[model samples]
Target: MSAARVPGYAELLTAADAPVLQVRGDWTLAHYRPLAEQVEGLRTRLGAGIRIDTEGLGALDTAGARLLHSLLGGERLAALAADAGALSGERRALLRAVAAAMETAVAEPAPPAGSAIGDVLEHVGIAMLTFRQHVVALAGFIGITLESGLRMLLQPRRWRPTALAANLERTALDAVPIVALLTFLVGAVVAFLGATVLANFGASIFTVDLVAYSFLREFGVLLTAIIVAGRTASAFTAQIGSMRANEEIDAIRVLGLDPIDLLVLPRVLALLLALPMLTFVAMVSGIVGGMLVCAVKLDISPVMFLSVVQNNVGLSHFLVGIAKAPIFAFLIAVIGCLEGFRVSGSAQSVGEHTTSAVVQSIFIVIVVDAVAALFCMEMEW
Candidate 1:
């Protein structure tokens, strides 16, 4: 029969006809299902001479192929079946050619262990390489930063007051309450701990000295910087990293804007200005917390606690802490902006860089603090 004029299936079959059945049509699972059922009726009558003539079939999906095999009693039945096509093109190729062969359909293959391990190693290698690339980029960025800063300093006219003030306000004024509250609690806890330990030795009076000296010398500034680093550094990385991902950084460059000047500088300046002020607030709140602990635990009057702090802690200690504020600010801003700029294509990259920014900022803060401590110790300041 001509391919286009394959019989409407029912006409080709008769109870009296030999068991050999010539099937035709689209040969889909839907069409073939009814015909397979009809075969059962013929089974009791004549017998099975089932010859599935697929020559006239236009197409066969995977489901149709499986149904065909099932009708044939599987592979042994498949040996009995014959193709209907006669020297047809690939498009009209036999069922085996059209559909993937079913090999006792079973479990899906497990993913290769070596391939998975290779994939993990590849990702790890990419991360390590990206880190190295970023370190080099950061070194270059630092050079650019120093050059820009120096130029801005030399030509004070280049410095925009609005930009500086805006940055300062964001970094300083907005961060005050959180910094204050955190420092206050830290100071209170320290004072309580010191008072408890010292009280055991009948040296509770020294709690004031401990709180005052620690806060002014290190804890107040370090804690405040760390908080800001975690909060604002991550923010900077996320913001700039997202912009980088979206190609806004490229747009800025196209517009002849120095992204560092337009973006990083303001943030850096704001952080530098804000950090010292935040540190001052932290110190004040911490002293107040110490006073609370002293009043409750040490039976020290507020006036006496204040008097002890004033006597034991000097202006130099406060100045030293304040000095570290700018350094911490620079580290936070630089590390945060560097991380943001490091972001490549994916959301995952942004997350990694943001995490790196926080970690690196905190690490640099501690390193700077250690150095400052050594300097202070050497000078006996």
Candidate 2:
């Protein structure tokens, strides 16, 4: 058998004005370690004016070619290509390919830096654009829902009473105990705080007015809306998103059915009917709790508490609160259904859209409440 050839080595020759690096022997991976170390040592000492002579190279491979190309750098390799005698046609082609690849691997330019105020302004602009897009989408969804609702009203046979009833039971009846319990506790806490503050001024009796005004005008509908937004809205998104992910919505469309009417109308109608009733229940529960607290802590009788609430709290306040409930319910249902339609065909998409639905429902409910509050204030309601 023939003896195995020795690994490659690089020799720096400094005899001429420009230094010359000569490569020789087998340059394959099996003999590449010593060649790599020798090339690396010569890399720093070599200058742009250095000449690489690869004519003596034997058994060259991709690894060796890469090592040599990197040692010479792209500019130097390009310059060396003109002198074709120094490398074989195959080695020359390999070197050219490596240089071209290295050139393409150049990093992208760094982003420009800006002042702190400029960065803040840029972020604000982006946020405003995103908000505008969200608002536009919501408005489009509302228009579609309204169109469906009008069509349903014109054709009463299209109504899904069973689905509406089921959703109503899920969103309202099952939710009653928690809504009442939460509002009741909040009412008691408000009464306690009001009594503590008013006692310093010797007007603890005003605590009944405080609790009644707050619950009847704000807390009742607002708390119920928030609860429904978190619970029913998320449920709507998850259910519809799962259906969308499974292509059931597409199947409905294929069967000549409108997904908006079949899927969204039931939820919207249910919430419209349910929210007002739940808000009324919340108002009553909260008032009862406040009455209990006043009776126990402020030495006020239940009859006197009811008399004060009846005399001081206007019917308009209850009307204002109840009026906001349907609007909030509409928005929550629309947002949930809209997000569900946005879902992609994946389990992850369902989860992400469900979360988005709850967040958007809550946010829009708050915005609507704020706007209504401002309108009521201006009108002196």
Candidate 3:
């Protein structure tokens, strides 16, 4: 650039203790190197405390700004004072604005503690809403199942025989031996206890009648139902839950198969068919166990024990036990299948619901039996 009239340089300004460096023009690479060297010399003596006076800069370019950046880091430049009044009109506006912003940033206040508490409350509200959604979904599922079951009563052709057979085998045949064995042991233990209590009353011979009537009337059916609930109810829930998790239930629906007919009705029908058969097996085995206890402990012959049981244990007691089997079967199948279908898209949910199905089935069975017993007592049969 040619020599031009420069501003802000006075002889008196150099006489002060502070150094005055003149900027030739709008900074160029050629002018920048000498200015940078001078700034470096000042930096060695003054560190970052050196002031950059942008006054009298004839013109400035990126080269000058870069040299200034090298002389003062952004933070140091923020702290440095600029001779705003002495600077060129544009440069004065830019420097003063940047310093003002830096000052505002440094003085900005932190948010209050109440704002943090509000954020926590917002998160808690969201969590509660999510929980409510899940509860509603579960309630809707139960309602749908019941509605579907009632509708199927008017159209029974949807229930396939083959599916019913499979469900029967799973819920009944597989469970028979276990149910029979448990009830047999229970009957034997009960008979032994009865004989021990009655011997003190001089009525040891009555153990055979006590064991037979109790087993045929109540313990046999109740024990079988409890066992099936633990075994078959849990199995049904797990099987259906697995189908749900693998999206098989959705596939069945897409293929025009009603999940209730294809999955639930079959299980219910099977359990209804299977439970009575299992209960019969349990009753027979339990009587046999009682006979064994009578022969060994009470010194009663097996024939005498059988005769006593036949004489005292009426057909009505056996009928009462058999009658409860169908109701118990229905509860076990329906609750188990319903819980299975209720499984969410998680393995933990499947397990939790499976356990709930077994527990709920057993609880319902006991409640029903209690009601039945109260009715029987009222009728005095």
Candidate 4:
């Protein structure tokens, strides 16, 4: 640019007793700094029905068109550019292009302001929505499982006894040792705690009653269910989730096979058959543990422990704990299998769904157990 070139300027002037902006200069990149300053002050006159006169406007590059575009704004700039008498075609196109760029370009918006209460409410709302969606999915899975189970029951020839037996051995037989060991240790701990507490009241012998009542009513089935949920539920999910990830489930569908029969029923039937038996094993093992503790601490014999349990704890307490097993088993199996089917055909999705299955199974088991406890207490059972 020549040193004698006029710097861009927007001057407010009066014409016909109304304010007008007069844009003049070579608004090239070299003139941008001064032009920017000029437009900054003159921007306030915009939208006041102020007319802009670019009739004598000269030597505008994009930089200059930008300055004029801002001063005139989009509508006024377009009108000025549109007027055949106002500018040459090249200048008009430059102004139009600059105006289009200025108008179409947008800066990203800022995030909404947050307050303590608003953040808390937002989190609570999200949690509630997530929980609702989970419930809906669980209910749908349950419906599908029930329908499939009912259909299988109607078709006796379709029974897969081999699958049922294999699953039972895996779930029930394989789990027995761990279940017995854990319950036995827990029972001994419970007895020891009971003896320590009751001894202060000179009622240490009631430790048998304490162990029996707790084991028969809650700990037996609850522990067994939790163990199964953690162990077998994860297995179920990983097995089926891998199937989904490998497209094996898809292949099964293509082959007109019902995966519910080949996969779900076997696991579901196994757990249902296995859990109650494990509950029984848990109860027996736990009572044996309490018996050993009683014999050691209170000098009460195993016979006395048995006698106290038989006399004081009714059959109903055992029934109460055992009755919840099938429900827990069904929920655990269905949740594990449902999460498996939810896999998004990826290894990562399989891993995620597997973990989800375990968490959901454990959570549902605990919730059901708590609700049953409340109901049984209210019923005086």
Using lDDT as the measure, the top candidate is 4
Q: How close is candidate 3 to the true structure, as a TM-score?
A: 0.64
C-alpha lDDT (0 to 100) for residue 288 of candidate 4 = 88
Evaluate all candidate structures by whole-model CA lDDT and list the values in order: 0.78, 0.88, 0.76, 0.89
lDDT of 4: 0.89
Could you give candidate 2's per-residue lDDT for residues 1-381 as a string of tens digits?
Answer: 211265677888996579888877777788778878887898888876776776677777778777777777777877765567776678778778877887788798999988999999999999999889889999999999999899889998888999999999999999999999999999999999999999999999999999999988889999999999999999999899999988999999999999999999999999999999999999999999999999999999999999998898899999999999999989999999998999998999989988888888888888888999999999999
Q: What digit string (tens of lDDT, one per residue) describes model 1 on residues 1-381?
A: 564444224224444545445545544555666756755454344334544444455455555555555544554234433333432344334445423356545779997667878999999999999879867876888888878787777877667778778767767888888999999999999999998899889999999999988999899899999999999999999999999999999999999978887788878888888898899999999999999988987789999988887887779888888889988998799889988988996899999999999998898799889988998899988
Instruction: Estimate the TM-score of every prediction.
Output: 0.68, 0.88, 0.64, 0.75
Please write out the lDDT profile of model 4 over residues 299-347, one tens digit for every residue: 9998887888888889999999899999999999999999898999888
- Residues forming the 10-long window of minimal summed lDDT in candidate 1: 80-89
Residues 1-381, model 3: lDDT tens digits: 443333212111242456543344445555755677666764444432234454445655456555544555556544433544555556545544554554456665786657778999989999899758645754665576667768877776754778877777877788888988898898899889999999999999899888888888888889999999999899989999999999999999999988887888778878888889988998988888888998899899998998887887789999998999998998788888878988896899899999988887889899999999999989976
- Return whichever of 3 and 4 wins on lDDT: 4
Go through the candidates in order and give the clash count of each: 3, 0, 2, 0
Question: By TM-score, how accurate is candidate 2?
Answer: 0.88
CA RMSD, predictions in order: 7.0, 3.1, 12.1, 5.5
| TM-score for candidate 4 | 0.75
Model 4: lowest-lDDT 10 consecutive positions = 1-10
